[model samples]
Target: MKTPLSRLGNSGLETSLLGLGTVKFGRNAGVKYPSAFELPDDKSLASLLSLAADLGINVLDTAPAYGSSEERLGQLLKGQRHDWIISTKTGETFDGKNSAFDFSAEATRQSVERSLKRLKTDYLDIVMVHSDGNDLELIERNEVIATLDQLKQEGKIRQTGFSGKTLEGALAALKQVDMLMLTYNLREHREGEAIDQANHLGKGVYIKKAFASGHLVSGSGEEGQLSSFRHILGKAGISSIIVGTINPDHLKQNVRALCQASAGMV
Candidate 1:
């Protein structure tokens, strides 16, 4: 069965309950997955995306920090562009093994433009700030939210938000943007209050690290995986849970889990 699509808060974007994260499509250098692996070749990535589409996933989450992920998606999703909701980020970049941050208004605008060029799209569906732990400072001091708002006004992005690390930041961001992406998983529920607040305000919420950053995934059995997914996706405010993978089997399994969890909801 195909996974169901839902309105992402009040952003007017319809996305699958499960969104595909594209970090593995472009980088694996500084990740903390249980094991180190080579980046998937183009052929493999194409197959993975095909499977995702077949399973009814419509959101693809990427960022400038994810190495060449945006570039690869631009190339591979050219003909199928209209079929997916492309979400990328600004404010951060990955240099093979280390990461860097820039939240200046100029850098934020430049990042969006660069992402547009790399994704081969004239406009992005969503562009979020990829925060480096200074979520509040980035918004209040650096004016990242204002910059994204300006870009949205300029027709460069359809929706805007931040992948915030702090609850205070997420809450503050909810008042300013159309969406908020945060870490929420079985192991961590600190963002639950923030999610509820976003939902109350009719703003979109995207869940990241639902599998505990791969540590729980590595340790969990099949039943354990199902329980974790059910708990996470059962929450009310989540527009989608973003999971990154280049493996077809994992993608299929994730879709199945989402289907099962959703069934329980209905």
Candidate 2:
């Protein structure tokens, strides 16, 4: 069966229930430990994206903070841009030297413009306010929301969201965001109530670290532990789970687990 595509809040954009995270594509920084998987350059990245598209995964999530990920995705997916739903983030500036938060209205506008140039797209399906689970006050400020609203009007972003680490941040953002991205695996269900609230409000919810930073997946030293956690998320009402892997076989395995979870076979 074809995977279902659902609307994000009242936005006209529809995305698959699963998304691909590109945080590892261009660079790896701030991660607690270095990844053993060989990082893909431009060509390999394109091939992987093509594979993902063939597998019925439509939503691709990337960010400026992810090294050269956004630029690489732009170069690789330029031809197939219309074939997928592309979601990216803003609210921060990266100079290859240091990164700093900038949620002001002007900064947000400039960020989206830069994203458009980097993605080589006229518009984005969704643009999230990239947050580190802190900065509640900045996120709630009228300037940021107003700028996002303006971008929505200009057709630069179809919908806006916030990627938060805390339930309180998510809750505070629910009033203005069309969707939310959070860490919501079996072990991190502290946002259960927030997920319920979003679902009730008809806002889309996207899960990150669903595998607990590869802990739930096999070969990460934590196997068989994910089944129960997967069960919990499937039953708890999550919209989509974004997991990253470098191996094609492992990607297929992840998809299988997702299929099983969707079929209530987990």
Candidate 3:
């Protein structure tokens, strides 16, 4: 069965119930996955993208902190750019060794421009602020959000979002941005307030870490994954869950779990 689609609030963006996270496309260092793996080759990534499309997954979440993800997507996603809803971010970048954050207006603008070039797109569907745990500071920074607002006005970006760590910042972001990217799973619901607020306010909500960085789903097998998917999707305000996987077989199984979960819920 095909995955279901949801309107990302009033942002004019529609996404699948499951979105692809591209961290594995570029960088594997400093990640929290249960296992480490090599970066996928172009052919491997091409097959994965094709598989994602076939499985009805349309949303992709990436960031500068994700190493070369944006650039790889730019080249790999070249001919089929319009077919997917590209979601990227500013404020943070990951060198092979360390990460850096810059939410200034100049850096933010430069980041978005660089992302556009790296992603090889004229207009980005969604651009979010990649937080560095200082959620409140970034939300209230004014310069960053204001810069995003300006970019949206100029048609460089269609929607703005915040991938933050704190509930306070997430809640505040709903008032300012088009959507909120959060970490929500059976083990973590601290952002419940922000999720509820986004629902009430008609803002989009995207979930990360729903699989506990792959520990939750992979160990439990298909039934375990189904349970995890059901648990997250069962939540009221969730627009999509971003799951990162480099294995094609795992992607197929994940989508199957989602299909089964949705069916059972009905």
**Candidate scoring better on lDDT of 1 and 2:** 1
Leading candidate by lDDT: 3
RMSD of 3: 1.3
Winner of 1 and 2 under TM-score:
1
Off by over 4 Å in 3: 264-266
lDDT by residue (88-184, candidate 1, tens digit) is 9999998998888999989998999999999998889999989888777778889778999999999989999789898888888788888989998
Residue lDDT tens for model 2, 135-233: 477776637767888899988888788887788888888888888887777677776677888878888777787777776555553344347335545
Better of 1 and 3 by lDDT: 3
List candidate 1 stretches off by more than 4 Å: 264-266
lDDT value, residue 17 of candidate 1:
86
Clashing pairs in 1: none
Candidate 2: clashing pairs of residues: none
Query: TM-score per candidate, in order?
Result: 0.97, 0.89, 0.97
Instruction: lDDT for model 1, please.
Output: 0.86
Every model's Cα RMSD, please?
A: 1.1, 2.7, 1.3
Answer with 2 or 3, whichever has the higher lDDT: 3
Query: All models: lDDT?
Result: 0.86, 0.72, 0.88
Please estimate how well model 3 matches the true structure, expressed as its whole-model Cα lDDT. Answer: 0.88
Error of 2 at 90 (Å): 1.2
